[model samples]
Target: MKKIKLGNSGLEVGEISLGCMRISNLHKKDAGYVIENAMESGIDLFDHADIYGGGKSEEVFADAIDMSTSIREKMVLQTKCGIRDGFFDFSKEHILASVDGSLKRLHTDYIDILLLHRPDALVEPAEVAEAFTKLKASGKVRYFGVSNQNPMQIELLKKHLKEDLIVNQMQFSLMHTPMIDAGLNVNMQHDAAVVRDINTIEYARLNDMTVQAWSPFQYGMISGPFVGNEKFPNVNTKLQEIATKKGVTDSAIAIAWILRHPAKIQPIVGTMNPQRLTDIVKASDVELTRQEWYELYLAAGNELP
Candidate 1:
């Protein structure tokens, strides 16, 4: 597996990470299988969210893994907070409380990275900064970041934050390309030209914030993945075509497409099956040419200006 630094944070992580959302569905024994496979596959980063599986995912992870001091030193654990039972909360109290909950559940004294899961419309940057300051001072969190946030939101928080927001988690895939769409459609008259999220990917690149692409295989928010969905015939066909040439599964090709970007985006895949995790890790070995990268993008029904 290939390793890349998360911006200039000087923290090194695998090119591909394992998202632990669905692993919550696995039994303790089964979850152990997934964790073992992930380590063997060189996926040292395990991404989680407090709200995922009602926080059962983190609890299960702590319970399933060996958790020896030696093993714990080799793993990087990242989790997100801020979304509550109904509304989003980034208040100082909420942020502190959320990190405590995550640390308790993960059985770790410190979190490698903590992200605000989603932007809280009522966010007070000062309050968030206060929370971060306390957490960092207490040695509860070593790094900080944001998820599903635009450039302006990041700047607002960064203005008050002493810690560098080294990572931004956003949904991007061959199927979900809004982050890429706006940039390519600049100066065009198409619907794709309609700006959304203010092209946050470019901001991350400019600011030295690593972009972590979640749902790397999903079609979109509500709809399921496009792998076998008849609604997206072209993309599935193209994935298989490239997978055949590379001698890997179509899913690996899908992930390879995300890793092919110049931004060095890390694709967070949420596959629970042990063998599936192994296959996805192989994407680190598959390289896509520029032509092939755009081919998969267009195959997903995105139009260029």
Candidate 2:
């Protein structure tokens, strides 16, 4: 599999990463198969969040892998903190305790990367900085980042942070093209010109932060997958067309579309099916031409001004 540096952190990770949110419901045997297949398929980075299945995902992951140090050494484990019951928390206390919980559950000494799961409006950047400093000093976290944050929110955190924020996880896919739309429709009167993410994509590119695309196949948050959905017949048709031409699954075409961007986005796919995971990893080998890329974008019902 192709490897890319994760933003400016100088950490090399697989082009595609496995999102472990849904593993909480899998039997240990099934989870083991998924993990083994992902590693064998050349996926070395695994993404997790403390809120996933109320932390059961991490616990199950630990059980599946038996928390082997040798096995852990081979993979990059990234998890998020700051989200809590019914609200968000970024206080130094919460961050520190959350990391401790994650480490204990994941059966690891330190997290390769710790991201603030979401923007907490009441966040005190100083407290966050303190939390990160302590974590680093204690060898609990190697890198820091945020998820679902806009450029300004990131700037606010960076103001007090001593370490570079190397990643910003966001919901992005062929069907959800608002980030690309605003850029293409700059200064236009079209609806697509509405900027939602405050040019986060450009900010990450400018600041050398890697943008990790989550839900790469979904059209909207909580809105099921776009592939094979009758509501998105055109996109499904094009996905199939390209998948047939490339001799790969349509899922690979969807993932390849995300990886084709010049921004070098790392898509976090959450499929628990071992075969589906392997098929999705084929994206590393499939390169979409510029024309093909745009064709797929338009197939998702986007218009270029």
Candidate 3:
């Protein structure tokens, strides 16, 4: 369980954070076992969203943990809001209400961090800033951030925010290379030069905002995990080769690849299986070489111009 400072907040957290979206579906006993395993494996940060399982995930998580001050103080709890039924809302009223609901559901007096789930097209920066000011002053949340937002969107929010945005949770993996493609193919007439994310990777690094890589093993947004998927035989072969050489699972290699980036991105793994979670955590010990890292990248169907 390697640890790193989250952005410039100086909050030390596990390199591998646990994503709690799927935990709601597990039985109470099973969820407890999973959480216990994660803690034992050195995972200290837990990622959650208000809409995850319609808030049932937070309920199950609270039920699983003791929520005592002693136990709560040892873990970093981060959850998202602003996402509602089929829409996004960042109004001051919605943000304040969402944090209250999250606090009640998670049985916590204060959240380590609260993030706006996704960018709301109808966002009001002042309202969000007001909500954050009130939450911070009341000790409801210690830090703030955003998810799935580009650099400019974050800039807009930062304009009115008194607190520094510490994180930008984004979908990034070996198979998902849009964040890097534009940079690699800069000033070229290639498809990889599209600049889909508006140079989010560089922007985040420049701003000292930690980029949390969600779905580190998934290919497309909803295309599922690519570790052993038949659709990506090349990637699977390369992963297995490296895993065998490193004496780890292919999943560990995939996670290690993400950690190998210079940006110091934290990967949020969403596995609820105890054995799988333990295996994935091995990534904290594995560091890929330059050649091996690029091999895995090219095998994922990415090309260099």
Candidate 4:
């Protein structure tokens, strides 16, 4: 298992981390099995969220982890907060209370990384900074980051934040490449084609923040993944060709596409199947050539200018 330094924290984490959202209430037994397999395969970073299953996800994680001192010591557990009942909260009170709840549910003393789940429209940067400062001082959270946040939002927090923001979790994949696509389609007539984030990939890279790619295989927003789906024949066809050439499964090809970027993004894979997990890990080894990368992008409906 290859490890990369997480942002500027100097903490090295596995290249491929396990997304534990689907592990909790959705598939209890499968989640446990996948976690055990991740350990066996040397995956050390476990990702979670407070609202993944209405706090039930963390509860099950506590049960699944089940008091294994040795295992806990070797792994880095990360979770996100701020997303509440159809709203976002980044208040000092909420942040503090949320971390306490997460600690109790995960059955751990301190979280390795805590992310503001999303950008709260009504966030007070100073309040968030205070909460993070207190948490670090008291040993509740080791590091902090944000999810689905633009550069401006992160900059606001950074202004008041004492701890260095380490990671930014976002929706990124080969098929749904808006971060890449918008730039390619910039100045087009359509509003949807306009560039968003103003180059978030470049922003994170320049700011020394790690980009965590969630839903790494999805075809688009809220749509199912494109793997083996006839709806995206071109996407699957290209994936098949690349997989055949690399002698790896198509899932690994999809992962390799994201890993090939210069941003050093970490993929949070959501598969519970051990074989699928193993296959995705193979992406770390299969280096996609520049031509192969462009070919796959073209197949996904993005025309090169």
Q: What Cα-based lDDT does every candidate model obtain? A: 0.91, 0.93, 0.93, 0.87
**Candidate 1: what lDDT?**
0.91
Error at 128, model 3, angstroms: 0.4
Residue 239 displacement (Å), model 2: 0.9
Tell me the tens digit of each residue's lDDT in model 1 across 1-305: 99999977899999999999987888999999899899899999999999999999999998898566777789889999999988999999989999999999998899999999999999999999999999999999999999999999999999999999989999988898889998998989888998988978889889999999999878778367877678988999999999999999999999999999989999998989889889988999998999999999999998777
Model 3, CA-based lDDT: 0.93
Error of 4 at 255 (Å): 0.5
**Candidate 4 residue-wise lDDT, 1-305, digit = tens:** 77888999999988889988877654556667778888777688999998887788888876876746776888899999998887889999999999999999988899999999989999999999899999999998999999999998899889998899999999998887878877776677765467777788889989899999999989778498888888989989999999999999999999989888888899999887888898778888898999999999988867865
Off by over 4 Å in 1: none
- Measured by C-alpha RMSD in angstroms, how accurate is candidate 2? 0.8
Q: State residue 134's C-alpha deviation in candidate 3, in Å.
A: 0.2
TM-score to native of every candidate shown: 0.98, 0.99, 0.99, 0.95
Question: Which residue runs of candidate 4 sit more than 4 Å off their true CA positions?
Answer: 26-29, 185-193
Report the Cα lDDT for candidate 2: 0.93
Worst 10 residues of 1 by lDDT: 219-228
